[model samples]
Target: MAGLDDITNKAKEFLDSGAVKDALSSEQAEGVSDKLLDGVADAAKKVSGGKFDEQIEGARDAADKKVGNE
Candidate 1:
């Protein structure tokens, strides 16, 4: 059985392996994330009577910026 430090090291290695970054950069992944965010934003807008439009747009812009940086 792996000790706590051994498990932590393996987890760190996996995270640093770039698999996650590659997946996030894929077109299919982008499409799925975009659709998910859109659905959430639409629901938020409806719940807020459209008052949260600006907030939703801001959140989308921030997310896009982060994705672009990645």
Candidate 2:
């Protein structure tokens, strides 16, 4: 949970600083967001003993959509 929060905060900082847009190309930004979401999903699945697959999938989907929006 703490790890996830930290990642989220870092991402927010990137957005707030407007560095993500400058530092990452559109494709790279999408990839990073996807990677972050996947990491979160994997961690949650592991912590829950594979019980949160659906939740993780939804999260991944949402993250992808957000990247698309950006």
Candidate 3:
């Protein structure tokens, strides 16, 4: 169980690494994250037929935190 736990948190480890954080915060990364989030949000809204617009925005914000260089 412990071994599986260790393997499952690779993203945490990567986020904790200072160099990786620096790279993630770079200008190029910023643009990429914006495009990625926007594209996903647009697609999702279309799929939902624009019914959950507010919730979709909230989800976009949450997802941005994960992949964005904040």
Q: Which candidate number has the best lDDT?
A: 3
Clashing residue pairs in candidate 2 (N, C-alpha, C atoms within 3 angstroms): none
Q: Between prediction 2 and prediction 3, which has the larger lDDT?
A: 3
User: Which of 1 and 2 is the better model by lDDT?
Assistant: 2
Candidate 2 lDDT tens digits, 1-70: 9999999998888787755555553777777877788788888889989887988898778667767335
Residue 29 displacement in candidate 2 (angstroms): 0.5
- Candidate 3 residue pairs that clash: none
Candidate 2 ranges with C-alpha deviation above 4 Å: 1-25, 68-70
lDDT of 1 by residue, 7-56 (tens): 99988898677887677677777777777777888888899999889999
C-alpha RMSD values across all candidates: 4.3, 7.2, 2.4
The stretch of ten residues in a row with the least summed lDDT in candidate 1 is: 61-70
Name the best candidate (by TM-score). 3
Q: Is candidate 2 or candidate 3 better by TM-score?
A: 3
Error of 3 at 53 (Å): 1.2
Off by over 4 Å in 1: 1-16, 67-70
Error of 3 at 8 (Å): 2.8
Model 3 backbone overlap count: 0
Cα error, residue 48 of model 2, in Å, equals 0.9
